[model samples]
Target: MAYRLLALDIDDTLLKSNHRLTKETKEAVEYVKNKGVYITLATGRSFISARKVAKSLKLSDPYLITHNGSFLASHVKEPVFERRIGAETVYQVVDILENYHCHFKLFHEKYVIANKTRQKAQLISRVNLQLTDPLFYPVHYVESPSHRLIDQPLSVLNIRAEFWNKRERRDALEELEESVTGIRITPGGKEELFINHESASKALALQNLASRLGIAPYEIVAVGADMRDRDMVSQAGLGVAMGDAPEEVKASADWITRSNDQSGVAYMVKEVFRKQLRIETPHQ
Candidate 1:
């Protein structure tokens, strides 16, 4: 079936090795855009980070699924949907991380609050490449009235933990699930834990966007490389996994393309558009 919408993940799927778009990829996207296909970006990064890529591609003011689906905004920067973790849940999670002596960073909109620890600040700095001044609010040195100090509608409650110890993380997540109503806990990277609402994810955001555009689930194509992206790949009409993706991720994909550094996305777009053009041509 011809895909009407193409949803691509950033990180290791769309961006190249150095996290930049290649000329070939840019040209391919432009070609597809002229073909009248709706191209959208689905990513774990926030809307701010995703916008750089969208602007580079010159996408048609399409919808964007950012923060793994916690936030959805249009190319014009208009918020179409958002799912925030409850304040209570955010407080409890902060407490839990503190009790376990695990470093973490809290994201409240564009403001990222991290303890004075260099480790936590470094993590935030890496993800938010442009964060020159990360407001260092020392968690340990805070004054009295700690309860009132908790932030509101935390976007991402990130915890730094041993990712290899799956059992420990799983137990923590299971416990968190019991306490929070609209929150979902998932693994982030190799040694980190990310918490967001159950309603937040690329799949949910795409579904919402599809509904708004009057497109069906099977009319879209999704591609990604992370475990968090499993649901999205499963739901898309044609789920593609990056060549460098883990075996588990590749297994879930309908097809495996080249690595991001090899211009995999550009190749996929070229093939899809070529086939589309062939279909429009008269039979021999």
Candidate 2:
């Protein structure tokens, strides 16, 4: 089958373990783009953080699926589609999180507002000096995020929290799940959790974008390596899982490629996409 759109998850599915895009991977993405396959990044990262990767790919006017598909937009200021957490829910989440020993960050389209925690919860660097864009997801540290939210409510795209202790993280997740009404919490990393609106998911956003592009579920390829990516991976026509992905994630995939460290994305593009395209294309 010839796929029309290719949706890739940025963190583990696309980038390496060190968080760098390799030349081979870039070329592979270019290969698919040259073949006229629509490529999009469906990531849990904010638009700005994902934009850094998108810009490198030279994707002209890419419709990015960011914040675990909570926000879908081509430009930073304007969004094609979005599902932000309500101000009341955001306030409740913040108030509940403040009781835990975790560093939570509020995600917006342009900013990553974080809490000033003792454990140094700042995950991203100030800026990539190599890039000219000064505000590449500029992070702002607030003393009390709950206070700020109470004063000026923000319709946050998602909330990411990293815990000092795994047990605390588990407890916090349990509490939040129990307390929150309209939020979906999923494990993002080792000690991290991402909270988004109940209705927001990579699959939901991907389906929405696919409909807009006139692509059917059977004409799409989705790749990811996390629990958050389960639906998208399973529902897509060709669901690919990284070699290092969890068993459950792997079980849902139609194909499993090498690990991210081995440039799994590049491998998949060549072995799966390229090979399939060759079989479908007639000789000149």
Candidate 3:
């Protein structure tokens, strides 16, 4: 089957252990790109973070479905689609998180608003900066973020906390689910919780993108590694999961490629296009 588009998740799906794109992955992506596949990034990262990885892979004029698909943009420009949580949702979310020992950050199109000016917030910023690639935008620190962010719609609310065990996280997840309306809370990463608008999702965002591009859902391929990636991966005609992906994500995938370190995407891409390439090759 010939897929016209590829929606790739970043983080563990594309980047390897060192949090960098491997040379083999780069060459494979460039090869597929040269063959005219429209490769785009669909990730939980903000636009700034997602765009950096897209450029690193040498994707030209990429369409990014970021902030868990709360925001969509092409070539890092204006959004083709966008979603934001209102102040009420933000305040309610903060209230739930206040009882816990977590550092909360409000995500916007251009800024990361840290909720507390205290030491925990400051420390998380430092740790995140160290863990992440060079930050692309400025983050403002405020003792009370809800007050300042009240009037603005936000891309996401990222909370950083330690996982003493699974139950701590499960309880928090249940609480959020029960307390909120018109909001979505997904805690996939080991130490972070990603919150977005209910209408915002990779599947919904990809549908919008596909409509604008005049592409059918069956003509697209989605590759991802997180639990949050389930929808997009399952919806695509060919859903691929990284070998290291969680069980649930793997269950949703049509096929599982090698681990990210082993160049899973490169492996999957070649296999998917191999048959098409053979058919198109002219007789010598």
Candidate that scores best on TM-score: 2
Please, what are the lDDT tens digits per residue for candidate 1 over residues 194-248? 7777677789899998888777888788889888788898888888888888787
lDDT of 2 by residue, 112-213 (tens): 677886564244331122122435557778999989987888989998887777898988889888888999998766588889999999999999988988
How far out, in Å, is residue 239 in model 3?
0.2
Q: How do all models score by TM-score?
A: 0.80, 0.92, 0.86
Ten contiguous residues minimizing lDDT sum, candidate 1: 137-146
* Candidate-wise lDDT, in order: 0.68, 0.83, 0.75
Looking at model 3, report the run of 10 residues with the lowest lDDT sum. Answer: 275-284
Best candidate, lDDT: 2
Give the residue spans of candidate 2 off by over 4 A: 120-136, 276-284
Residue 73: error of model 3 in Å? 0.9
In terms of lDDT, model 3 sits at: 0.75
Tens-place lDDT per residue, model 3, 187-217, is 7665567788888789889888877776789
Worst 10 residues of 2 by lDDT: 123-132
Ranking by lDDT: 2, 3, 1
